[model samples]
Target: MDTTLRHGPFVMQLGSMPVQNILVDKEWNIKQFIEVQSICSLPIELMLPPSWITGKDIDKLLSTEDDRLQICYRQFAHTLRHEEAKRPLLPNGRLHSDTLIDGLHSSKFWLLQALQSSGNPLHTFRRVKGYGDNYAGKGKPLAAAAFRPQIYDYLKYKIASYVDYRKDVQKLFNGEYGRVYDEEDLDYIRRRPIVPERK
Candidate 1:
């Protein structure tokens, strides 16, 4: 009955077997596995502000002297850049996959909400064309053109699903994410609805 060995600083442990065999299969406390990082706060700023979420005119707010969007957008972009800069760069001058996932996690959350509601918060803030659209790669596939947004859309689909989103969010909090989808999965996701059937 000994839950003796702890994993790192987390409370997760391997329980000893009834027959006193240390070689027995490890029993994992799933609740502890989740609770290990439950204390960590989600990136609340990554979510759109209340006004934006409630269908207010974010573009007008951004245009006016009101600095809400300005301040929040600046912090969001700064955190994104900081996270990207901390990651190892690739030969193609792009940041690591971690940067891409972090960016998409934030982007998909904000953009999907905007797309479902009234205004385009991230798009208006960044002044990007079709930021969240073009999921099927409608145009050129080069660089950050249609291809990037397509991948972004795919990730958005993955995130919109509750089960997958929880896994990704857990990984996001843990500062690591495995591949959520593959090429075959992408083909199927593209054929499916843009907004996932579930939250």
Candidate 2:
């Protein structure tokens, strides 16, 4: 039997929900939600494993051209800095520990490496708990939640790209039939116009 799954923007071969829903909650605005979704649903072609033949593979990946992942790291760093700045003071109103800042920088480097080598953000970000926690209470420590100048901006930028990507993909597959008669016909079917005229 053939089945079709409908989402706000894109469809996949499988009937299960796309992973994006797990990342963004329903309360998020449509644009914010879809942007996260697009990043989550990026095609494999856009992701290529870097050659990890030497010292600190993660560092090498972040230094390379993949701007999308770079933005994510930048956001992560900004989040860390903001949180560190807000740490409970040592009576003199100064931060108690530099640990969080160090961790953020370190994690950013590793995350880039892991993503490049593994093509899995979860794997790359396993050490950092802020992205999302898989386990209920056994997750890694999260950076403190403090407002940073760049964190919101980077997040907004990434989310915007994600939204645009989702919109484009959804528009690309809006009104196609649920099932294809033949597997070989997919290319032709995808090329067919699926966008509906605005009413």
Candidate 3:
């Protein structure tokens, strides 16, 4: 009956002398319980940026190089974020699981799209090899052995300071944030094969 004591889907109680409100549900569950004795209240904490921002940055970086390169980088970044987000947030400050899962999904989608668009065996092979190396670290040596000569030739003539960007990127993430995948996490990601088609 009192305006100060509001009740609808939820209840809110306000006092005149003391500026404070108590919120509760019909079941008496404390949906929100706040005590304000003064004119000021606790400062609100800011939310962290969505993990996808990193992936988007990588995409922008690669977009200027080559279409294929752009696609590969975008997919990789997206996949990594998606996968990381999907995982349950660990107390150890690792990435969120759901992010990683979603990132991987985006990566796979883009990878397939790039392959289809390029229709170049070498590019496809290199991209796949990169993805494989990222997880298993098995195909890297072979990919390097095969592609190094061409990559070297490409870099030799150009003055675009050549370096293992993948390694650099990984290191950057690790140093700034933390390890994206530990031994156990890698094993889990590897074991969960991405089916070609959704069932």
Candidate 4:
């Protein structure tokens, strides 16, 4: 089986890569992904530094006064802004579904992890509070309030089930996500307990 194919510079086809060979989670890898601008401007994107390096490392990098990690939330928070990120909700309220999808994929690994278990991270994009003129998420009754935490919460639920990932991770990695959660299956994961029921 040919495993390597290289194009000009952007396309490298690793044909039929096995499941386990793909999805991998490492603290250093996540931090590196952030530094590479590959996972920019998402909410959990801020937490990557702390998870990969140290929370103090983040404070140090963003700190101004005396370069002290002593206590600096403002600068640290500002680093997470990706130009359009802080834009206020439109006059009324609304989050474009496509924009929501962008936000979800921005945290690609996060979505992958979420799908590994019982959560559907993409659906949470609805919680982002869609409003204002021609709010794109309006007609798409699927998206919620456009809240970032909703996305994080879903991811957290999947991560919390760390006893081991569900075998379904394979099907998810196959990239048929849209088909797997067709409109009818959207909220299936929401009802699943975030944390396992205490025995």
Best candidate (score: lDDT)? 1
Candidate 3: stretches off by over 4 Å: 1-95, 106-142, 145-154, 158-199
Task: For model 2, name the residue pairs that clash.
Answer: 35-162, 35-163, 58-113
Global lDDT scores for all candidate models: 0.42, 0.41, 0.40, 0.33
Q: After superposition, which runs of candidate 1 have C-alpha atoms over 4 Å from their true positions?
A: 1-66, 88-91, 95-113, 118-199
How far residue 43's Cα lies from its native spot in candidate 4, in Å, is: 8.3
TM-score of 2: 0.21
TM-score for all models, in order of appearance: 0.21, 0.21, 0.16, 0.15
Where does the lowest 10-residue lDDT sum fall in candidate 4? Answer: 1-10
Candidate 3 C-alpha lDDT tens digits along 1-199: 1122132123122211111244778995656646643332211111112222333322232434445444554565456566656652233444433333443444432343333332333333334323433323343333343334355445555544444566678777777656666889889888998879868
Q: By TM-score, highest first, what's the ranking?
A: 1, 2, 3, 4
| Local lDDT at 7 for model 1 | 20
lDDT of 4 at 45: 21
Better of 2 and 3 by lDDT: 2
Q: Would you give me the overall lDDT of model 3?
A: 0.40
